[model samples]
Target chain A: MSKLSKKQKWLVAGLLAVALCFGISPVTGAMHIMEGYLPMGFCILWYVISIPFVVWGFIQLKKSIDANRRNMAIIAMCGAFIFIISSLKIPSVTGSCSHMTGTGLGALLFGPAAVSVLSVIVLLFQAILLAHGGLTTLGANTFSMGIAGPFLSFGIYMLGKKFNFNKKVTVFVACFLGDLFTYCVTALQLALAYPSELGGYSASFVKFLGVFAPTQIPLAIIEGILSVIVIIALESYAKPEMRSLGFIEQEA
Target chain B: MVIHWLWVLPFVLLLIGGLIYKAYRHRGEHHHHHGFGHKHGEATIAVDTYAYHSGIAHWNPAFKVVLSIVLLLFCVISDSVEVSLIIICFTTFVTVVLGDLSFHHYFEMLTIPLVFLIVGSVIILINFSWTPMTNVILCLPVFNFFVIITHDSLYVTVHLWARAFGALSAMYMMSLSTMSNEIFSVLRKAHVPALLIELMNMIYRNIFIMADTQNRMRNAAESRLGYVDYRTSLKSFGSTISNLFIVSLKRSGHLFDAMEARCYDGELLFLETEKPLNAKLILMALGVVAYCVLVWVMTRGV
Candidate 1:
């Protein structure tokens, strides 16, 4: 049964384009608000509460690895790979730059569970070495981009499949929405943390939404196109290898 | 409003107590397992999975669905700083105590935000002019005796700092404990659109892939003595970034191709786990609702 119909393909593509238009084409991406901008007591409260969930996730990951040791090894290696990759910085328009976070790729390859584990590892290393994010806020960051991003992408992909859309269009839509959702969730998180300085709910939300729309939208689109291109290339040249890796199932 | 030192002290004590408890518990557990030599075997994974299943199994997914919506609503409706700070701190404290994390771990987590708070407050105080009354209260000798609590400047400083720390810590804990997958699951259960979730998933996956590629390229360049000097480092770094982008672009292309061949029709299949609503979940939801309502009532005139 085809997952996406022809009409669905176009719809997915259009949605992806829209998401890209709002997520990545602007400078607002640079204003990553730090912890303590909001109320301290609240920040501590949330950090404490999030522990069990994180522990639960860790437990789930451990189980998955135990069941499939090879997959576990692959995930660990990928986690290490992700750590290495995020260390390299890419220059943005401003003098300052942002590095690539390969969480998206991890999700595509191993699903969100594996990606979450990889993200936790990368986040830990980043906190200890680069001081990009605080140890206290690690749970928050992981939940925001790590856990939220992959599932969003996967859910979009599943929805597209239901409609029987074309493969290229499906991938594009999934990538775009995934990127957009991450930014949206991130904005929501920031808004929750610093609603006052951010100008309260309505104003802060609109501002936050407006800020990331440009940068993340285009970034999402670029991400979509890039993903599509890579998938198409792999289909033609590395199909067998990809299949062996369980990235793509062979048609009956 | 005249700030009462006594009122603030209890809140501080509660916060400190929570942190210490988490640290102690975590240490205790670590010690208890030390005799096992940190068993890196498959059993660890099994234990982890068991914990995840048990934890999630206890919750009613439907309750989470409702809670998320209500939480989002609270985020929108509660505009008062005092109210928000109260909510943040209370929730954080409750979560910490409930989660069984240790005091040391909690404190370690606070270290970064505390430093930032101190530095930022000093900067803000320096930049802003204060009223005479504020200055007098802030400069009170007695206030300085209790970790620098004062009326004017000190009061503002402590209030702002506490507010900031409380808010960040609350949100941080929530995000940390909640799995991204669970968030998506909650959304899905709540009937959020599938396409939105799929896109989020893809972006999540690719971020790491791109990061990895960039790191490798930088290392390769570094090994070749590419970053020996400042000028060379800049040049090398620039080229490396460009190269990374190109490579990322190429990799995305490959992923698309792979997806296409797999009959990917713009949709991803997710295995739905069974999550039934129960009385416990209902109770939890009711508790949150009641708390929110109470906050609303108390802060109505504000």
Candidate 2:
């Protein structure tokens, strides 16, 4: 509802820094890790990890629905936002073609919980109807694009505001890092699934990371910039609604 | 030197070409959901359209989903390329012959996954390492390491490629035959979380509404030279997104009021022109399962 205190800022920044260092990167094979790429066991493991988060999100969703009837529609609108943005062919970063995750703005507006729900659904749609992501690997994809990225995004936004950073720059950083971190988590997922026998997990991880850098790096940067533009535009165009959503605070 | 390594070269070149084409074509050309002729999201729109016209459109959507999943399981469990090949052929026959998709359009749709499989398998087949590889069919020196390919790797790659292609084809069959609304209804019937199903239904309906709103904003911006340059394009796109978010939020509020006016109590219900179970289709699905089992039995150790 309001700005965070200094201690809260430090806590968020610390948490984000740790997340950035660890819960890192995604690679492109369509919008997600793709289906049949990971083993059944790994997929199950990721799904198990994701269940708690999705349950928490589901609870939040039910609460929203119970609180206001319009919240359901608004949540659906957020889902549409995720679908349209992730599916759109954005400006190429490096040489690899990729799509923006569309998680940042929603994470900033609706919180990470809502984005988590939105992203899994979006990924599900991509997998089933569009044949992009696969059903088996849904959990891994969701963790990377949905949970990891959104948490990074929401963290960056909070820290940026607490540090008195410019809103434009803050949006850009939140989105850019959000994209980068999503793929980082993805690369980890892949490397874990298919570790390099010679070099073990670390080597495979680096290789996956190296493979994605040319495109993912540039893609994340552009995502950041685009998110900044989108957030700024929303500030002007949907000021009242955004304020109501608590993305913007009540006017003094 | 193993000649099998040569198998990946043509696919490699094709991939390079696709990448170059992708990099150069920057103007939001086309994709799954939004683009006019977008290459990827076509499955979503195509499936919905085809379901309406599909000969087996009257077939139960849930049955089709189960049928595809079964076929997909068969594809996944088998390691033999022959089994995957069979699965793909069977899936194609079902989609084209039974599901009623045009062969031409079907093949066009096949290219995406086929190419993706080839590209992914190529990378999977290659081992990049600091030390030179032994027993390699072909090796290429890169920056400071070697890209090694071997006969076994090639065999495995082919198997994996086939498996992915087969599994995807099975999904295509289901999607091509099942409508989105029908799929949602099936999910609802299965008791797969009422809140999620409801949200998805609304989102699915609103996607088009938002897309229209976005298109209008883009056109209005373009008419006034809002996208003449990179910076302008960025600005135009940004404002359009913000405006869409704003409009969707406001519209949702209005929509809620409108629904409430009509005595809408949160749950949005619609008619699902339900179809009775077709014995022929059910038998055919069972035949598919039997074929899969036959493949598994025949190719147990391959």
Best by TM-score: 2
lDDT of 1 by residue, B161-217 (tens): 654554455444444344445555776766754544554455445545655565577
lDDT of 2 by residue, B153-272 (tens): 677677767777778888888878888888888888889888898888888877767766776777798899997876787677777777778888888878778878999876778888
DockQ of the two-chain complex in candidate 2: 0.25
> What are the DockQ scores of the candidates, in order?
0.05, 0.25
Give the per-residue lDDT digits (tens) of candidate 1, residues A61-174: 667645753343244445654554444333344323333445565566656766775676567445432334544456666766577777787777777777888978987787
Q: How many residue pairs clash in each candidate?
A: 132, 11
Cα-based lDDT at residue A14, candidate 1: 78
**Across residues A125-226, which tens digit of lDDT does each residue of candidate 2 receive?**
888766667887899989998899899999988998999998888888888988889888988898887666556788778877876676678777878888
Estimate how well candidate 1 is docked, as a DockQ score: 0.05
lDDT of each: 0.52, 0.74
The top-ranked prediction according to DockQ is 2
Candidate 2: regions farther than 4 A off: A1-30, A93-97, B1-36, B39-44, B142-144
